[model samples]
Target: MRISLDGQVALVTGAGRGLGRAIALALAGAGAEVVSVARTPADLNSLREEGGALIRPMVADVLDASFYAQVEALERLDILVNNAGGNKPMPMVDVDDETLDRLLALNIRSVYKTAQAAARRMVAQGSGVIVNMSSQMGRVGSPRRTVYCLSKHAVEGLTKAMAVELAPNGVRVVSVAPTFVLTPMTEPMFANPDFSAFVMDRIPMKKLASVEDVANAVVFLASPAAGLITGESLAIDGGWTAQ
Candidate 1:
């Protein structure tokens, strides 16, 4: 069944590339006007160039608390996608204070701030959808992925809490938790044979979930098809969580 979002307005964080880019494009293709937020000018420019009138570049750090007002004023934002996050490989014990802080700020705090801001706007609008990106690691566990897993688990928690609170306002919050998507951030991990095996072995499909896989889930949650799905996390991990 084809889903369409003809009159919807959306704001997607990390829209420069990877899962974010895929989600933004999918939303637009389904007829939503998308506000693409990202830190890099070139990535945002690329989206604008490729998306034409369907996409608007919204440059702002998701970490910025004041960006909510900017976002609310700029777009109706019928849909919101929290898809920004990253952290390099590090043993849990060896991870420094600075790195941990930075990871938490970008992955966890940013998602919270953006979702909070979007929730207020959505509540006022009286109808909206918010899709937060998470990971199978959030539901399961893995070695060396401690920080990333922690950040995503927090995302899952936020989604649940916001869904319950925002449901009264007609706002639904959901999450797409994926395993080993091919994004720039994950390139190095895929290159490492041991890491790749560690990831693939647990996944029943023995393959990576594409950006499109995660993006499609985001679009579904943002659309009417998922009108009843709230505070639920849909895992696209090829059964990694099942394992």
Candidate 2:
């Protein structure tokens, strides 16, 4: 079946590049008016040039409390893709206090705050969809990614909680958990042949998730097609999580 977000308004964080950019483009292509948020102006500009009127670029750090104000100002918001997060891979024993704090702030705190703000607006409007960006690590543990895994595990829990609380208000909350996708954020890991091969070996499909793969899933979750699908994490891991 075809999914269409015609005339819908979607807010996608981290839209400056990578999967966020892909999701923004996909949403726009699906006829949604997209509000793309990112800290980098260049990436936002690039998206605007490509998406034109359908994509409205907004430059702001998701950590900023005012960011929610900006989202609330939107005339109407139907979809929220909480995609802004980062990870600094390191062994749990070697992880510093500061690094752990930063990861928690970016991955968990920001998601909770942003979703809380969006859910408030959505409850008033009486309908909405929230897609939190998670990772395969969220479900399964990984070496040198303890902090990242913990943050995403929290995200999974938060997604379920939000879904339960918002369902009564006609708002659905879900998460998209993807295996290693080739993106600027992950190029460093893929740069090492051994590391790349090790990653590929874990995926039964022997392929990494693509930007389009995750973006398409987000679109489906946000579309009427997934009207009843909430409080769940859709794994786009190419079978990595299955292993």
* Cα displacement (Å) at residue 24, model 1: 0.6
Q: What does the lDDT come to for candidate 2?
A: 0.93
Clashing pairs counted in every model: 0, 0
Candidate 2 regions with alpha-carbon error over 4 angstroms: none
Q: Which parts of model 1 are misplaced by more than 4 Å?
A: none
| lDDT of model 2 at position 38 | 96
Q: Which lDDT value does model 2 have at 33? A: 96
Residue-wise C-alpha lDDT for candidate 1, range 23-46, written one tens digit per residue: 999999999999999889999998
- My TM-score estimates for the predictions, one after another, are 0.96, 0.97
Candidate 2 has what TM-score? 0.97
Task: Rate residue 121 of model 1 by lDDT.
Answer: 85
Candidate 2 collision pairs: none
- Candidate 2, residue 210: CA error in Å? 0.7
